[model samples]
Target chain A: MLTLFYILSAITLGTAFLTILSKNPIHSAIYLVLCFFSIAGHYLMFNAQFLFIVHIIVYSGAIMILMLFTIMLMNLNKADEKNKPILSRIAAVVAFCLVALVLLATFIKSQPVINEYKVSGQDFQSIKVLGQVLLNNYMVPFEFASVLLLVSMIGAVLLSKKEHINN
Target chain B: MDQAIIIEKGIFIVVIFAITMLFAMYETLAERKIAAWFQDRVGPNRAGKGGILQPLADGLKLFSKEEFFPNTENRFLFIAGPAISMTTALMTSAVIPWGDKLTLFGRDVILQATDINIGMLYVFGVLSVGVYGIMIGGWASNNKFSLMGAMRASSQMISYEVAMGLAIICLVMMTGTLSLGEIAAGQHGWRWNVLYQPVGFIIFLVCSFAETNRTPFDLAECEAELIGGYHTEYSSMKMGFYLFAEYASMFISSTILAVLYFGAYNYPGMDWVESVAGANIANIIGIFVLFAKICFFIFFYMWVRWTIPRFRYDQLMKLGWKMLIPLAIANIIVTGIIILLADQNL
Candidate 1:
């Protein structure tokens, strides 16, 4: 399990670096996808199969696709797509490095190491168990999530249609 | 599980995984041959006998082909598109029960790779992930047509998923269990649920075609408009993975359809086979029976593909949402009512 955890975590971080380092917009998008997938792998390693699938659905299935469609629609392939100049790029890189260094230091210090680990199997996984808890204990939030999705869907359609209406 | 059981399960997983890859490879050949027959032409007889070995020849061709990338934004996303699709397609097989239990050396050997009780749900979850492959591939292509294709895929998939989920909910309510093996067991000995839940079966069957991205529901790669669809920019082996994964999902999903609703490894008078041929021989026959059912579904998929025309986007959405969803909900309610009445009589 530790081996699995390390592999997934490395993939997550490595893909993130590649996501930034990759020159091509399509390549970056692909790396972003790789990052999302690695995160999903992490979810599975943590025994959250439902979360893993949901993450893939939300991020890989929908969000990344939305991004891809946006990129294609805008015809940003010939150039790097970023309008920011070289000066901004250098500053952004420096800031990113600083942020990463600090975050890494903090993560190492804050990492949780389980010694005598014990967790109830039913509590850890299973939709039936999750469903019971969700409806009873977290029903408000669960319902709210649907409302959030509805809001976003409406927003997207409205925004996409703005171009049509204006024309 | 003990060490020996663990070892056995490992071997079982390997075998099942290999079988899935092999079936998927062959399905590609079968699809081309089928399409050829429909067109009154011989397909790829040059590669091997009756074009049986054509898949390997095609695979080699893919490898030897030149690769090119259109200057595109987000090259990472471009590569990620097909990889996601391929992996997700293979993931669904983790829970499918391939055959009935085999008794060896006084030990009961289950035929599934992993009988994790939440098997059906797992398949649905993984199947949903295939949408990303199309969406991302299209987007990463950085072409107008590709983006349109991806957008079409996303909307179509999400809409159909509601009906698909409802169909599954109906099945779950009837079986009272989520385990695939248990589902197969329930449909044993000619007492298949298709007879009982014909409407449910039909809904599931239709949705499966869409879920697998077969023709009529294959809006993602409609060559008529989308210029090769999601994989327009991809070339060579990278492209082949996306195409191969679709067939892989098609074959595996068809198998799941057979095992779940149709009588998997079970036919009328299956008991008599065991009586005459003995347990070992009968179980082998059962495996063959399951294979025959899978072939029938594969043919059924092709038949439908050639028969129906591609749906307009709005029309597809309406069917999934208005017609299918409502019907599935009604089916669930009706099933509950019947089950309750039966319990009261008991």
Candidate 2:
């Protein structure tokens, strides 16, 4: 199980690096998809099958497709993108280092303890249990999320609509 | 896991893979033969014995054809597209319960590849990924028509999938299970979900047609407009893979439809047969019966293809968003009400 975790983590990090390193936009998108898939693999390794499938469905399936479509629509396949200015490049490097340092500092400060694994007989992550929890306990948050989504969808539709002109 | 159990799983996977490929192969022939019959023309009878060996011949031809690649910047994605499609198509069968269980060689064997709790969700996830295949392929082709086809396919599939998921929610409510095996088991001896949720079934059927890009919802591959659609730039075995993946998906979807709504591997006299002929023999017949239902659905797909003209893109979207989505939602609401009412009464 540890070996599987290491392998999945490796895959996830490798593809994530490739997603940025790849020159072509399409290649980057595909690599991003691979990265998402690997993350889903990690979820599966943790035995969170429901989360794994949902993650794949939402990220790799829908969001990535939308990203790819936008990329293709923009015809950004050519390697004609200008390199960042030297100042911007240096700033980006500094920003990356800062973020990494902060993340490392946070991790070190937390002093997280690993709990001994215990097998729970309850099927907590199954659809039925999840559904009950969502509807009963997290009902308000769930409904708020749906409302937010609906508002966004309506906004998108309204923005995309062509104006009617009377002659 | 025990070595014997591992071996059994390995064998099961191999068998399922082989069956998927075989069914996909014959589906091509069946499509051709059925199309010919509809058009009053004899199909390819030249290969061997009413062209029974036609798919083999077709495979050979595709294999021998010159490998052709269009001028494209993303060669990797072009190749990955069909591979993804084929893989996802085959992956769906993993959760499908082909039969109940068979007693073989002093051991009980489950016919399904895996009996995961989230079988329906897994299928939906894999199917949603199928859009990437067409999208990547079309984009990699560096052709406008192909890109347009891919765009249409992605949008159409996404829209219809909403309806499909909603329709399935009705079934999930009815069965009170997401596991395909459990759903199939619930449909014992003619208590099929289709009988209970006819509206949901029809919505699901339509959404499936759209999802699979069959005729009437095949705006992505309108030959007159898109010029071979997303596969316009592919040739030889790569193109064959895309086509094969479509038929494989069709077969899988048919199997899903059967297992979900049509009482998979369950007939009226199944209990009687089991009592008389024993568990092993009964399950063997059950497997055959399941396949028969799958074949009928496959035929129904082809039948609808030949009978209906392709829908205009707007009409397709309208049907998906306006018609099917509302219907599916209504079905869900109605199902929920009935269930609540029944619970209250009980």
Candidate 3:
């Protein structure tokens, strides 16, 4: 089990790094897909079949298609990507450090929660249990998330809609 | 996993793979034979007395053909495209319950590769990923027509998937389960989901046509506009792979339709047969029944392909988004209300 987890972790991290390092945008997008698939593998490793399927469908299937479509349409040229200015590079590094520090602090603060965790032999990862939790305990948040998605969907439709004028 | 179970599954997978490949190969001959029948012409009759060996002949021809590669920007992706397509097409069969269990040497063996709890979702996920094969192949070819074909394929698939999913949601609501095995079991003895959810069935059927790039929805590869579509630059067995993948997906989708809506491995009087002939004989008959239903759907696919004309790109999109999506959504609402009322009455 540990070996499988390590292999999946290696694939996820390796593909993620390759996504950034790849010169071609299409190659990067493909690497990102591999990264998403590896994450789905991790979800499956946890025996969270529902989560794993949903992750694959949403990320590797839907989102990556859209991303690939955009990358394909852009007709990107590697020569066009000039090196970043020193000031912007420094700023990027600083922002990255700040984000890392915040993440580290959050992890440190949640150490007790992690320590308290136990493998209670309960069927929490099944679809039934997940659905009940989402609809009951996290009902409001879930509904809000749906609303946010709806708003974005409507916004996309409106943005793409054409207006006609008779002058 | 037990050693015996591992061996069982390994053997099962291999059998399933062979069946899928064989069915796909024959589906080509079937398509041609059916098309010729519709056209009132004689099909290939040279190979093995009535063209029974035509698929083998075709396969051999494809294998022996020159491996032509155009000067493309990405040779690797060009090669990977058809490979991905074939892999994803075959992957869906793993989750399908071909038949009920059979007893071999006093051990009960399930007829599916894996009866995952989310088998239906697994099929859908794999299907959605199928777009990458065409898109990569098209883009890597660096041809305008191929790229256009790929674009149409992606957009059409993405659009139709929404309605297909909504249509399936209605079935899921009625069945109250996502596993194909459970769903098949639920529809025992002619209590098919199609009887309850005809609207969803029609919507799903239309979407499957689109998803499989059949007939009216095959604008992605329409010869008039895009030449050979995404496989324009492909040759030899590589081109054959794309065609084979299409037929394989057609077969898989037919199996899914039978399993989901039609009574999968279930016929009226099956209980009587089980009681009379014993479980083993009845289940074996059940397998034949399922295959019979799948064959009917496959025939339906060919019939529609030869009969109807391909849709215009805009018409395809509008039909997907406007017609199918709203109808599917309404079907879901009505199904939900019915279930709620039934529960209330209970």
Candidate 4:
């Protein structure tokens, strides 16, 4: 399972890199989807079923679909190849690379690798345990999440809709 | 590292993969047949008995057809779109418990190909990735229709996802279990969670329909407007892949629905089957039972597809943001209150 996890993670990381590097938005989007699936696989490797399904539903299902809509609405598929100022693109790439390097180095140093151990416990990824914790221990945060959703909903509606026509 | 266990899991996965592919292909046939039936005529009965072999014939034709590559700019991205869609669609079944465990040759062979604790979350995570497939395919197609399709697919999926998550949260609250197998086990009879979480079930059902890119909710590939939608320019195997992946996802989504809402592999008299036929055989039979449930869902997908007209873009957005999300949130509140009252009584 550890080996499988490592393999999946490598594939995910490699795909994420390819997603960014791909000149075409569609190609990048597709690669990004693969990266998402690979991450979901890692979630499965850890036995987080509810999270896995939700990951697919929210990220792959909803967010990706929105991204697709944005891409189409903008008609940016093949237009990406239109030559831009080379210096700017090069500078942007360099900046991104520097950020990636710093982030990777810091992350590697901050988190020490631990020896692998046999997985043990009741495997409380079950909905029952999640419910108990969500309703009791994390009730405040849970309620807040709902409030956040409500705000976002209102924001989306307000942004999408025209001002009231009341005269 | 026993050879038998390796072979066991390997065979199970391969078989499931094959079944999924076949189901997807059949779903295409079913979609067309259902559409034709709705229109009062025979569908494709030329290929085989009642068109049983149509999907295979279609596959062969696709394999033999010319793979056209329009002189589009993002050729690589265009090529990658269908591949992503197909891969993610099939990848989701890894954690689903198809049936109970079977004891064979002094070993308990798990019916599921893989049983991880975060199975539900893993499925969710993979679903998010699924967006890339469509987005990439559309953007790469270098066509307005394709791009538009991809865009619609993304926004529609994302919006519904929030409501879907909220709906699932209610159930997640009620059952207090995230692992699908346990969810199924918790509802071991006709006393399915659907009865308890009616609002959640409806919301989840609607979201699932939207998530799967089915009709009425399918603003992404509305053929009347988009002219064949995202795969408009795709031909040969590339087109086949996109279509195949849709079916595969439909089947998987239906299974997820059954496992979550319906008593998955748990009929009313499931104990009798285990008692009479013994655990292993009964479980194998239970797998068949689960398949039947999934077929009905696939049928339902087709039935609704033909029966309803697609929603306009704004209507689709409104359904997701204004209607479903609020309803789901309300359901959560109701469930919370119920749980609170129950706790007080106890």
Best by TM-score: 3
Q: Model 4, range A1-167, lDDT digits (tens) per residue?
A: 78998899899999999998987675577578668878878877767766666666666666666675565566574656677799999999999999999999999788432221123344366666667768997899999999999999899878667555432
* Kept native contacts, fraction for each prediction: 0.41, 0.85, 0.89, 0.89
* Candidate 1 CAPRI classification by DockQ: acceptable
lDDT of prediction 1: 0.81
**For every model in order, what is the iRMS?**
2.7, 0.7, 0.6, 3.8
Query: At residue B324, what lDDT does model 3 achieve?
Result: 93
Against the reference, the lDDT scores of all candidates come to 0.81, 0.89, 0.92, 0.82
Write candidate 2's Cα lDDT for A35-68 as tens digits. Answer: 9999999888768899999999999888898898
Tens digits of per-residue lDDT for model 4 on B1-346? 5888799899999999988987888888888898899999999999878999998998999999999997687788788889989999999898888887878888898878776666676677677777778877887777878877877887687778778878888877787766777887788857788889988989988999998998888777787799888889999999999988888999999999988888788777778878898888788787888889998988888888877888899988988889998899999999999999998999
Writing each residue's lDDT as its tens digit, candidate 3 over B91-174 gives: 999989989999989999999999899999998899989999999999999899999899999889999999999999998898
lDDT of 4 at B286: 77
What RMSD, rounded to one decimal, does every model reach? 5.6, 3.2, 2.3, 5.3
Query: Predicted candidate 1: interface RMSD?
Result: 2.7
Q: By DockQ, is 1 or 4 better? A: 4
Question: Which docking category, incorrect, acceptable, medium or high, applies to candidate 2?
Answer: medium
Interface RMSD of 3: 0.6
Please give each candidate's TM-score: 0.79, 0.92, 0.95, 0.79
Better of 1 and 2 by DockQ: 2
lDDT of 2 at A158: 72
Worst 10 residues of 1 chain B by lDDT: B121-130
